[model samples]
Structures are given as C-alpha cells and as structure tokens.
Target: MTSQPPGAHLPDHPEFLWRNPEPKKAYDVVIIGGGGHGLATAHYLAKNHGITNVAVLEKGWLAGGNMARNTTIIRSNYLWDESAGIYEHSLKLWEGLEEDLGYPILFSQRGVLNLAHTLQDVRDSVRRVEANKLNGIDAQWVGPDEVKKLCPVVNTSSDIRYPVLGATYQPRAGIAKHDYVAWGFARRADEAGIDIIQNCAVTGFIRKDNKVVGVRTTRGDIAAGQVALCAAGHTSTLTDMLGFRTPLQSHPLQALVSELLEPVHPTVVMSNHVHVYVSQAHKGELVMGAGIDSYNGYGQRGAFHIIERQMAAAVELFPAFARAHLLRTWAGIVDVCPDASPIVGRTPYDNVYLDCGWGTGGFKATPGLGWCFADTIANDEPHPYIAPFSLDRFVTGALVDEHGAAAVAH
Candidate 1:
C-alpha cells in the first residue's frame, strides 16, 4: 500500500511537547489535575508570581478529559456583572494568549452570535447586550436580518418551529484550538521548571489540623506548602477525601462534530431556547453541542437521546447541516454548582484552594482564572475578580446565578 501523507484530515497534533517528570518529594505548590485550567494556572504561577517550584499532577494524560471534549466556542456575552467581568477579562487575555505563551494557539476571533428564538429570548438577549455594554464588553443586539447577514446558512425565516427573533452579538468572541491552547500553556510551564507529571493521581491528602501539608499520590507521597484543586468533574472526590462538601453535582456534557466540509458556517451561533450551539472549527468540521445529561454521574458519555435532541436542533437552525455525516461524538463530566457559577476561593481547610464548578464555562475562563488563581495562591487571598464566587457565597446567600446566560445549562 502507498504511504498516506500525514492524515490531512486530522488536526495537527503536537508530540513530546513537554518532558514527563517524576514527582518531587516536595514542592511549594501541588496543583491537582493537568487539564487546561491546571496548566494555565501553572504557567501563570511561574510567569506572574515567579513561583517555579510547582508540580501539576494528572490522573490521566494531559488535556485528555474535558479539555479535549469541549466544542471550543469562546465568548463573554454573559448577563450578570460578575460573570461579565471574569469572562470579558478572559476574552481579553485570549486576544494576546498566543504571543504571551510563545506558541500558535490558532485562536480565531471571527465572532459569536447568541440567537434569540422567542419574545422572551429576544428580551433576554437585548438585556444581556446592554449589560455587556455597561461592563465595557463589546456586545449588541442584532435582528434576524442582521443574523442572516452574519451567517448565511442560518434559517431566519419565521416558519420554523423556533423562529429566529434576534441575537446578542459579541464581535470579539470566537473559538481556538483547545489542544493547542493546553499544549502552549503546558510547554511554557514545563520550560519554567514546573513539573508536569501525568498519570500521577492524588489518592488522598496529607493534612495537619486545619492545614493541608501534602498529598498522597499513586506515584508516592509528595509534600506541599499549598495544594490547589483543579480536578474539574472529580473535584468532589478530592473534597470528599478532605472531609468537606462543595455542593457540586457532576454530570455528563456531550458534544459532536460533522465530516469536514467547505467553510459554510461563518461564525459561532448559540441558541439557549432550543439548546444547541454550533460553530465551524478551524479544520472545517461543524462542531455542535447541547446541555448536560439530566442525572448526576461521573461517566464521560451521555445518553443517545441527548445527542438526538442536539442533532434535531442543529438541523432546525441550519437546514444544510441535515445532510452532513457525523464524524464523532464525545462527552465530559462537568461539575456544576447550584447557582450555575463556579466556586474559586479558599476552601475550609487552610492552604487548600478550590477551583471547580465551572460547568460549561471552564475552557473560556482558562487564562483569566489562571491569572487570578495564581494571584490567589501566591498571596493567600481571593482576587477581586473571583471574590464574588467564593465558597462562602453559598452560605451568605450571595449567589452569582448565570443559568439563563450560561447557554448550555438550559
């Protein structure tokens, strides 16, 4: 058989980007989970705080879980002020992330449109646009005609089941190569003398009275001055080991992609009413996804009915998508909070930080949270941007609810 030329269909995969190091006996910090958030935090810890004595432990391969499974849509058109502040900060960081990391992340800021279907969606979209504008974020409400102009493939006619009413447009919003983003952060962190240890799962915590002194891992016990939890879906397991509850429910969130086609989809389009989000990836596949599964579980796969609903919504929004063959479908276990907002602050135990409950917004908030998380870890104080999302907010009844604007949570 003739040799194939590097599988032109697949996205360029980086090989041996970072060294696989053995866990040191002790470090100034030990970050659990080597996903995008963990890697970003590690990069910022060394770059911003000058803290290079750190180790990022991963249960599996780097970015092999939710980081690899997400649909890769990045936007900051959130409704609330707290949500807008953090997400918009993330969006700004995304703008210069490639240069800062000294790697090509393939970030495309083509734009994103959050479609409004009914009168309620239209009202909410307009309100969110105004809210975004008030928060210094670039957002505007566009009618169906304008939506059709932005993405020609969209069916804006009123005859559809969920007719296109209008949409909230954020010109700075877009998607990036998820794998490239993770690799970029990992490489930079690894180069800074931070250990990136894969397959090193944290079996338990080594704690003194009200303080986490170290961690017990699969490889061996490693002492730490501070321990940060970035485990995403498995955060509850870690917290359970520490004898505390975070009020997070883990669920399977699924997404899929279609066979590569000519770039017909111009930009990312999300509809919360119908519960389907679509965007054509850099590789030309139509990426699609919807909400999490109804039940709580750690499984990285969802029920067939969820995928069926997602496809139906996709077909209804873009008639042309019905003919495209499905390339593949996958899921990630996302730990969601009661208020649909993330919890990022000091845990009940001293020297232990909490960074979970991002739900579907984890990928978008990677760099921004990393920047702030590094500060939080370095100074032992919550950054102002993430202060409102403290674990104590639940007890204080000061929730930053983002269910309506979170899109996928619908």
Candidate 2:
C-alpha cells in the first residue's frame, strides 16, 4: 500500500494540519476503532509497554461512534462480581484521567442515586450496594429521608406509580465529558507515536495459517503483527468479514439533552421500575436516556415515542422537570450480547483479539477494558478480569450476568 505524503492531516486530529507526516506501511499492533476504548488501548500499549508501533483505524471522525454519543455517566455499582470489579477499576481511572492525560476530562464526582420504587427494586438495590461495597466501591443503601435530602427536587412521596422506598447511592459515581475523554486519549496516544487513522474502514482481514497478519482498509492495506477488534456496534459485521459469527446483536439506544436551565438536578438518578435515567450536564442541560430499541437494526434513528416515554417517566420521578423542554435527541448503536456482558479476549483465531459487546455500559469501562485488552494482546492470554467474558462462555453457559443492574442503566 502506498503511504500518504509527508505532512498530511492525521485521522483523529480534528483541526487543520499545518504539516503532514508520512504514514508507515506496517505496525506492531493495529486497533480497529478510534473510540474511547481503542484510543485508550493505544495509549496504554505505548505508555505502559513502550509499544509505539501502533495504529487506530476509524471509519469516521474520532469518537464519532458510541464513545461520543453516550450520556457520559460513570459508575461502579454493578450487582455481578465480574462486572463490579472491572467497573470499579475503570472508575478509579476516571478519577485521575485529567491528571494522567494532561487534558481536562471534566470528571464530576456528583454521585449517583439508583431509585427503588417497589419492594423488589429496593431489595435489589440493597443487594447491589452490598456487593459493590464488598468490592471496595462506595455504594450504600439510603432511606427515603436520605434520598430526599440528597435530591430535594425528586418526588419520593407515596401515591406514585412506583413509590420510592429507598435507593442505592454511590458517592464516587458521576459524569465526565465524553468528547474530552476521547480527545485526551487521542492526543496523548498520537504524541506517543501511535497513528490515529480516520475515515478508514476495515473491509477485510489478512490471515495466514489461521493467524491474522494484517488488515485491509479503505485507505489501504496495512500489515501488523497483531490485530485487535475494538469496534463496538459494528463488531459483528467486522467479525463476519473475518469468517467468524458473533452472538452480538446491534440495537439503537436513544438519549436527549434539554435546553439549558438552572442547576436543579444535582446527582444522577436512575429508576429500574420506570426504565429511565436523568443527569444534568455541566452546561445545565438535563441529559436523559431510556432502554434500548426493541428490534435489532443498524440504523441509529429512534421514534419520537421513545423520547416521549422517557420524558414522561422523568417528569414522574421529578415533578419539577415538567417544564424542561428537550433541545435535541440523538441515538447510537450498541452491540449487545445475549447475556448483556462484554466479550473481551482472544477469538477462535490465534492472533485476532475481540473487545466488543459493551451493551450499554461501554463508556464507563473505557479505561479498565483498555487495560485488560492491552494485557491480553501483549501476553497472548486473557487477563483474569476479562476471562469470564470470553466467547466460550456462550456455549458453556458461564455467563457473567449483569442484566438485572444494567437494565436500570447502571
């Protein structure tokens, strides 16, 4: 493949390029995706292991996929052991992202409250809080009085659809700037000599004797010693091109941002019984999200009814939000596995690594997933943190089930 002329604009760089640099024909590792996880992987591979011969391929602009489209809520209150441990590590990384990257990720430790409206919901919240606490995360069950004191705008009184009994509160759970996180990682990775290739689509894989040797992209063919697939929603499609079938199904998940208003919503609030979660952005815009689309589709479009249902639920939880008009709505495709957990290890192929099936919790897992995935790629063995999410679990029924907690937007 012919390399681009010297002093060309890098794919992940958003601004104009004063000077273009020549592209290398090969790399030690090629990561497919410029999203948060992909960029983070490149950063760790270079900074942690001194692996600078790396390239990240992106079909569009950097972080144009789920990484930039998420609501940016970060937390570690999962009910399952495997998920809780991994997410806790990710949260710890987020706490120091600004200092580590030298770019402000704007991580706000505003805390998160998982509201329990029914008896069963309360029981589940209590159980998850205990699980998270045992995993060294700050999660606790709070009574109605405590919930009201934390979020006075919420309607926690009785006579509601799902009366608020209590909630699980995580003081460390909060929000971050999604775009900033992606850009911070991208800039740092680029500075470390990792090529960030944008507008590059991986059409096929080059394999010899059942081992992936390189990737064929829209730009051109690039040889690599190892290839890691970090494409989130397009993971199944990419795998199919490589002659493998994944159990992932892509679905559209929608979220909205309301017009700027006074700071009323303090903490992130999620309700399982209502299937809604709401948090206020740093700009005073109330960002809200609901469950995934019922059917499977590659399209990122959602019907208006989805947002309407979510708005109604939000208003029901916080009556004061009744007048907050929504400014815009957006959608993103999520690759959901059968068990709603991720698949993050070697595939059937020898050298091809898999890092997909994030479902709805991928954004918060950027750091931890990258840390584990880099280890898997470097050591040629799945890390203990991600061993439970292997592809073999599907057939062996060793699923790391987090459907209960994730259903309510954990």
Candidate 3:
C-alpha cells in the first residue's frame, strides 16, 4: 500500500485542504448538509456569533449537492420587500464575501437581464422594477434596444415567436465560481474548529419529550444541543423522520454547458417566455438552463424533452449558439415551496432549526441565509432577515410572493 497526498490523481481520491475529521460524540450544533449553505452557517456561527462548537455532517462531498449545481446567478431585484430585503442583504454580503472569508470566490459583477417577451411580461416586469426601486434595490427596465446593447449576442428582433420587448436589468447581478464558495467557507469554518464530517449520513434524530437532542448517523450517535437542517432537497426526508410535515417537494432541476468558446455573451440573459437562461462563464463556456422537470422525483436527472425544449429556445434566442457543441448536462434535486420561496426558521421541534425549501435560489442566497440562520440558531429567535420566511408563515398566510420569480422560477 502507498500513501497519497491531497489532490493526488485517481485511483486515488481528491480531498480538501481541510478534510473532514472524525465525528465527535457531541457538539453544540449539527448542520445536516455540507453544501454552501451549511458551510456558511458554520462559518457564521463561529465567526459572527462566537459559537464555534459546530458540526456539519454530509452524506457526500462538501458542496457536491445543489450548492454547486446552480447556474450561479446572483441578484436581489425581487418585487416584494421581504424577498428583496433578504436577497439584498445576501448581495451586500456577497460584495464583501471573499474578503470576509479570506478566499477568492470569483464573484463577478457583470449584470443580469430578465427579458420581457409579451405584453404581460413587460407590464409585470415594469411593475416589478418599480417595486424594486421603491425598496432601494438597484433595478431598471431596459428597452429592446438597450437590452440588445447590454447583450449584443441576443436576438431582439421581432421575427422570433417571443421577441424581446424589454428587460429588467440589475447591474450588480452576476455569477461566480460556485465550487469555490463551498470550499472557501469550509476552509474558514474548519479553521474555527468546527467539525466537517463527510460520508456520515444522518439516520435519525434523538428526541426526548418531543425535543430533539441529537441525531444518529452512519458514523455514530452524535448528540448536539441544537440541529440545523440545511439538507436542501432532502429536507422532506429529514422532517419526515423527525415526525413533522411541510409542503416541500423535491424535484430534479437540470442544466447544461456548451464547449468553451470566445466570449460572446457579455451578460446573463434570461427569458421565461422562451424557457431558457444563458450566461457566458469566466471560462468562456455558454452556461445555460431552464425550468425544472414537470414531475417530482429524487432522481438527479431530468426528462430529455425538457432539455430539448430549452435548447430549441436557446437557439431561437441566440442564433450564434446554434453551432456550439453541447459538452455536458447534469441535474440537482431542489426542495420547492408552493410560494416559490424558501423556509428558514424554527421547526416544530424546540431544539431543531431548518434552512430548506430554497429550491431554485439556494446558491445565490448562501451568505445571507447562513448569516441569518446562524443568528436564529444562536439566539433561539429568527432575525429580521429571515423573519418573513418563518415556518409560522404557512399558518399565518404571510407569504411573500415575488412576481419576478414567476419567470424561470428563480
């Protein structure tokens, strides 16, 4: 037998610079997922709240879940005040995230354009833009000519079935290297002495008198004072095991990238009417995606017809992409809510918290979600940022629906 170092080529495994250590029998808090959100939560719980006794338990590799599976679009030009507030807080943290974490997340500030293809889309987008501006969110409506200027490669001509009438542009909105986000947070969280337990699948919760005290995992029984369920798409499973129910349903969301190419698209272009959103990555690949599969399943693969429809729309919107070779495709399971928003607050269990139902918007929300969630866990109360997303909203009917999310559902 031979020893291998981190990043050793296969037949060997690649490990993080700060790999997961042995699971402790107990911790102050245990976050059930090691995605960006979980890592960020641990980091904030240590860095911000000074609650360093934390454990992030993952069934797989860190950030290998939906955190790294998204298109990496970051924006907070939501229509409602609640949606805009939390996202804007996340966006602000994103502006300083790299510096705060001491890691290069490759956060870009290019721009994001949400196209309006029909009369209703235009009307709704205009209203959404107005609401965003009223809430002090940076958002503006660009006419077809300006939309073409922002993204010259786009087909704004009226000949197409869904011609671009106008668009809502958020100049601060852009994409980042999604993988580095999780790794960066993990590195910092590990430095804070928070345990990162990998390949440790949580089997069940340890509850006494209806209060969760710890969890049973494949590794061992690790008791904790508090637990945060950042399990994302698998939230229902954990909630089920803990004897509770939520409206969250898991669905497979797919995305694909084209072979590397010369920089053609300057900004992110999204068209809900066409059902395709595309952006040029820092590597010059045409990164694109569409809505989720119509059916719900735990499968990480979506129906081919849905992808075919997305490709058709892509070619229709960007004729230049017609020749771009499709390199690869993949999917991530997302936990969707009926309101197309997220749930981030206390669960029924007194000692358990939740950060799930993020569905399409988890990646962009990593920083803000973690910050507020860590506060909620440490203080035993929801912060103003996550107050609207409380589990009680389902009963109070205080849902904060954003019309901007009506398109591509993110």
Candidate 4:
C-alpha cells in the first residue's frame, strides 16, 4: 500500500485496502474509539514507545463524537492532589502540542477565571487556589477588583440571585483548537502504521477462557492481542459485551456558540454560583457551556430549559450577552462516574484495558490519559499516574472527590 506522510490530505494518502467481509486479522493493540484520546494513544504507542501494530476503530468520522462536541476548555485547577497532578501534566503536554504533533493545536493561554458568588464560594475558591498552588499549578485567589481587571465585561456588583464575591484565577489555564488536536493525532498515528478503521462499530468481544482476545466489530472480527476500550459515553455498553459491569451513568452535556462578535471575551469565565461558563473562540464566536441534564438519556439531544438557564446565567455574568444571538447549540453524551473521575487501567480480564468515565473534563486530559494508557498497554502494566483511577477503586470505595469546585464546570 502506498502510504502518504502524516498530515497530508486524504487524496494524497493510500487507498484503504482492507475492506469489510474481510474476516479476522491480528493486531498488537486495538483501541475502540477514534476521538482525540484513542488517536493520541495510537500516536504515542508508536511515536513514543515503538509500538506500531495498533488499530483505532471508529463508528463515524474521526472525532465525530464528544471530542468534536466539546467546548474546548483546558485547565489544571483541582482540589485533590492526584487529580491536580494528572491534569497539570496534561496541561503541560498541551502547551507543547504544536512541537510534538508537528501541527498547531492553537493553544490559547488566555487564562481561566472561576467566579465565586457567595462568602462560602469565596472560601472554597481560596481553598482550591491554595490546593492548586501546592500542586505547582499557577492558581491564585482574585477578589472582585482583580476579577474586574481581568474580565472588564463582567458585572461583578450586580444584585443577582448569587452575587459575585471573588474568583480563582489560573493564568496558565486555557483552550485549544479541539478538532486540530484530534486530526493531528489521527494523521500522525496513520503515518506510524496504526490502522484507523472508520465507520466500524464494535459488536462484542472475543474471549478465550477468562481473557479477552479481540473485538467483534460490525465490519468483522479482528484478532487483537490486547484491547483498550476508549469509547467514552458508550464505555458501559462495550464493557457489558465483555460480561463486565461498569459503575457509570451517561448524561447529555449541552453547549452553544454565538455569532461572531468583535472579540470581546478575552478570558475563560466560569461561575459555580450561576452554573455557567463562557469563552470566545479565535473566530470571534463566543462558546458557552453549562451543566448536564438532570436525568440520564442515551439521546444526544438537549432540552430548551438548559438553553434558557444558560442564557440567563450568561446575561448575569456579562450583561452584554443578552444581545448576542446564539448561532448554534449542540449536545454530547458524557460518561460520568459516581466520583466524577475517570476509570483507566487493566481490567479483571487479562489483555483488556479501559479508559472511560471522563465526564466533561476529558478533553483537557487527552494527552495525559493517552500517554499513560500507551505505557500501560506497551509495558503490560498500569502506569502509576492511572493507578488511582482503576475500576477496582469503585468497589474499594476509594473515590477522588472534586465535588466542591470542579463539579459543575468539569
């Protein structure tokens, strides 16, 4: 097969020789998602660890799932040490994405300001600021005056239901071009000989005795030495096919983008009190997001109530948003764990791995999770960074709770 260099246009790449009705073929590793995490995992496995025989199975176009649907917020401010450490490392990786991937991810270090409304909110922000600082993340407590200086458009003194008191500022926290990250990894992984099989759905797992051997996809079964399920919202379904239960609930998270305005919003503004966050894209559009659905649903559709509530919150944060016309709205399924942390590492089955339950914070963690997952798959052992988020933690009651501050936004 004539292969093209990484990042070359599709027409320049070799035509896919392996088509359906072609039965089972063996692979060293198989990842069950073509989003940023799975693609990044494939890229790292080949680029970093010299593991070339990998396959990424995608049901649709690459990054057509949550990776494409995210609002693209990246931050490393968390209350717990483990969470802080992992995300901070992820942030660092994001900073150098352009150099590593040889494609500009367009990382904007525009800063993230998480607003505190109540006196209790202010206290919680202070504690979180201190915690993030202790973890060596650039987080600081900013009062109303400082908050105004950072985001002059915000109405800090408004007599709303939840009045603003203070905020936690992280200058290093920012956003990146979400699609570019996914495409960059996909292109590089493809160049590294990782078979990216698109329009393929995994039907079941091929098990030998107590161990998983490979995956049975809609296209056909592929014999894989090891299988890693990175299927985000559909994580539980895939695990169930393998005869294992996952402690996860899938919910729909909605986000909206406004018509291109004249670049007013400079910083990412998050409000725990109002339960909303907004940031402007490079194209001058304002990307706004809010909490998930009250009830769980497999449908990716969102409710009108969420849009109304988000607009109300946005207007409260920045009164000018009331005049800003909402251009489009979209929703993606978020796989949430009971503790709001991801489950990563080897499963009870030998040769089976998992990377799921990321909820809303998964976008920022793509690089970190992918790097650790690649190491785990290549070395046949879970990396220390992912040990705390293992599936066994649920049964053992070892939950890394980030409920106070990181709850809403993440």
In model 4, the number of clashes is 0
lDDT of 1 by residue, 59-178 (tens): 998888889889888888888999988888999999999899877788899888888888888877788888888999999889999999999999999988999998888899899988
- CA lDDT, every prediction? 0.90, 0.86, 0.88, 0.86
Off by over 4 Å in 3: 1-16, 403-406
Worst 10 residues of 1 by lDDT: 1-10
Residue 21, candidate 2: C-alpha displacement in angstroms: 5.4
**RMSD to native for every prediction?**
3.1, 4.5, 3.2, 3.4
- Each model's TM-score, in the order given? 0.96, 0.95, 0.96, 0.94
Clashes of each: 0, 7, 0, 0
Looking at model 4, which ten-residue stretch has the lowest summed lDDT? 14-23
Off by over 4 Å in 2: 1-13, 16-23
Which residue pairs show collisions in model 4?
Answer: none
Model 3 residue 380 CA deviation (Å) reads 0.5
The per-residue C-alpha lDDT of model 4 at residue 89 equals 84
Ranking by lDDT: 1, 3, 4, 2
For model 3 the local lDDT of residue 136 reads: 88
TM-score of 2: 0.95
